[model samples]
Target chain A: MWFDILPSFWEGAKITIQLTLFSAVIAFFLAFLAGFGRLSKIKAVRFLAATYVEIFRGTSLFVQLFWIYFALPLFGIMLPKMLAGVLALSLNAGAYGSEIVRSTIISVPKGQTEAAIALNMTPWQRTWLVILPQALVMMLPAFGNLIIEMLKGTALVSLVTLADLTFVATVLNSSIMRPTEIFSVLLVIYFVISLPFTRGIRWIEHRLSAGRY
Target chain B: MSVPLKVIYNEESTKSIGNDLRKVAVQPIVNYSNISKSYGDLQVLRNIDLDIAPGEKVALIGPSGSGKTTLARLLMTLEEPTSGTIEVDGEMLWHQKTNGKLVKANEKHLHKVRGNIGMVFQHFNLFPHMTILRNVMEAPRNVLGLSKEEAMERAVTMLKQVGLANKIDAYPAQLSGGQKQRVAIARALVMRPKVMIFDEPTSALDPELVGEVLEVIKAIAAEGEMAMLLITHEMDFARDVADRILFFDQGRIIEQGSPKRIFNNPESERLQTFLSRFNRH
Candidate 1:
């Protein structure tokens, strides 16, 4: 049964890998935009960014995915399963990631901003040249955990019938009637796949955190 | 026996004398007109009208919370005044003439005016992620639009002047308090600002480290061309470096005169009590 299921699982794994990678990239970009927006001096920009974070974070990723996949067609805007899954994960993960970006940026000392200002730097230049670099160092530890959570969040894509790893594992269980072996194998596979990501994040965190307390 | 006196009219000395004459001809470099600052009805500074001449070294000394630091911050534009205007090098800092009408200065105008002033903070405030050389070079290259080579050369010279030339590649965390303050001075000097403000530059240092930072400041004062405003508690150091001392009390300049006069013949009871406390410490 394991042998028979290997090819199907491999196909599902490929989609899952692509989905997680694309969603994480998109989510990372969104997090920065939203995070900076929240800190923007302009009230409207701050409010809009805050709204995005709250709307996504206040609700369930499961419901969000289901809405885009199942309900949005009623409005004559049908999205492909993969697109819906990726969109849901990106928005959800980006919301949480924005807080990580914001808090880290805020935690950088007020003295840094004052020093930059005294140097006659414009607000944009100060943020770019001084504040962001230091904040990025502080964000790495929190960002590592967020990335791992994003990876785990990709598992939900299976529910929308995207034939992700979990979807394949479920199919195999129903067909083979070997629930114990198939489910255990599925669990082992997820842990195996997620191990390198966790290790990679730790490596990155270590590298970025040099000379930073 | 008598020692022969040789008269040497070196070009550098002549040029320095010419510069001094030029500085004297210009009006005050910084002028504060009826400046008042208040936070939620608690007045920090009150109707402070002052003029700092070119090449002048004015030290602000008073007891804590008497608004000495607030005055320095106002000059640096770190804190805005609730009323009145400030001018640096004859240009209004928070106000600008537009269409022959005075209007509140915008960001662009502030940046232009701010280029003429530099501030050395008590905490040093060096960019922790940058190397010492980068911290010194950043404003020159970015704000002043100097070429990388030019900025680096200026940074090296200023660092050498501060006696931290060897630590250019070092991080701020790797430096002692004295060394960090030196780097900050170098950073400000690289901008070649016409007005320099030192906001208790020695207050944050370890007692042993204060002398080294003050020595660098004294050297800068000795070669005075820029106007300097120092808010400091180091009374003796102030006497040594300052030509003029303003004694502040409860947000007002109670007595201001030559450092000798202020130190010796303090008029106000508040300043007298403050100086006595300072002497006891």
Candidate 2:
């Protein structure tokens, strides 16, 4: 019976993995864009970035997923279900991640920027070459936590009738009447999928922090 | 194998004449005119006028909060003066000329002018994440657009000059305070700026470590190719390295003269009293 359900679980796991990765890519770019925007010298840019961060972070991700999936169509802008799920997850996660980026960038000592300026570096060069390299090392652990949160957040997508792991498990449990065995298997699968992400972040953190430690 | 004596003599005479003409045409490498800065109501710098000639070594000595570091910071564009203009290599630093009028300089103007200046901070702000060689090579490679090979060559030579060639691969945290400061000096020196500003360069080091850092600075000053503005509390080091010294107190330069006159003559009561504190040791 375990072997029979394993194949179904793998199919569902694939969808969950895909959703996590797609959303993570979008979230990563948004994290940097909003992060740097919040610190931008232009007032309008700062305002826009702050608004995005606050709106997403201050509200519930569950409602955001619903709004994107169910509410966006009211304005005649219909996104496919997968894109909607990915969009909501990324936007929500990116908001929280931008704060991580902003705070870590801020925590990089002021002297680093001054030193870069003293070298006659342009603002872009200062940010990319000097500031970000240092900020990145500090940002990884927080970002690691965020990635895991995002991975877990993918379980929410099953509610939108997506055939992700949790949705498959629920369907299987109802049909087979084996809630105890199937749910335990479902729990193990999620934990197994999350392990590599945590390990990968640690490996990257170790590599980036090679000399400092 | 010898050249004609008369030919050598004529060449020397013409070279001397050229030197005289060049001196008249050359503007001060760094100039500050009527500069002042304030944080809210508390003013840190008052109306001040100063000039640093090419290859000149000027030391600023004063009490804490006397605004010596502020002078260097203003020149480096780290802090904007509340009023007045600075010029670097004959170009306006804080203001640019537009349509025969002086307008506050933009980022492009400041970047161009600032390329002529380099600063070493008291904290030796080497990028902690970079290896020593990368820290020194980064600006020249990215900012100056030097090729990797060229930047690497320059970085190696500079590290060697500072006696840290063996530690090129080391991170800043792995080095002593003095070693880190030496890497910082090499990082600045790699830029080959017309003016180098040292803001209490050795102040953050251990007592025994100070000598190594000062030795690197002394060697650089001895090259006599770059103008140096050193703000330091090391009285003896200032006296040794400075061609001229300015005594700053309460945001103003109370006295300025050769190191000998500034140290020995003791004209101002404030300067006299200031020197006495160091003299006590």
Predicted complexes: DockQ each: 0.63, 0.66
- The value of fnat for model 2 is 0.85
Q: Provide the lowest-lDDT 10-residue window in model 1 chain A.
A: A204-213
TM-score of each: 0.93, 0.92
The model with the greatest DockQ is 2
Model 1, residue B125: C-alpha shift (Å): 0.6
lDDT measured at residue B231 in model 1 versus the true structure, 0 to 100:
92
Candidate 1, residues A1-213, lDDT tens digits: the string is 465656667887888788888888998899999999999999999999999999999998899999999999999989999999889989998999899899989999988999998999998899999999998977776776777787778789888888888888888778878887777777777788788878878787777656434
Query: Chain A TM-scores, one per candidate?
Result: 0.92, 0.94
| Candidate 1: tens digits of C-alpha lDDT, residues B51-70 | 77677788999888999989
Top-lDDT structure, candidate number: 2
lDDT by residue (tens digit), candidate 2, A1-213? 666677879889989999989998899899999999999999999999999999999898899999988998999989987888899999999999899999999998899999999999999898888889888888888888888899899889889989999999999988988888888889889899889878988898788667483
lDDT of each: 0.86, 0.88
Off by over 4 Å in 2: A1-4, A202-210, B1-26
Query: Residue B136 CA error for candidate 1 (Å)?
Result: 0.6
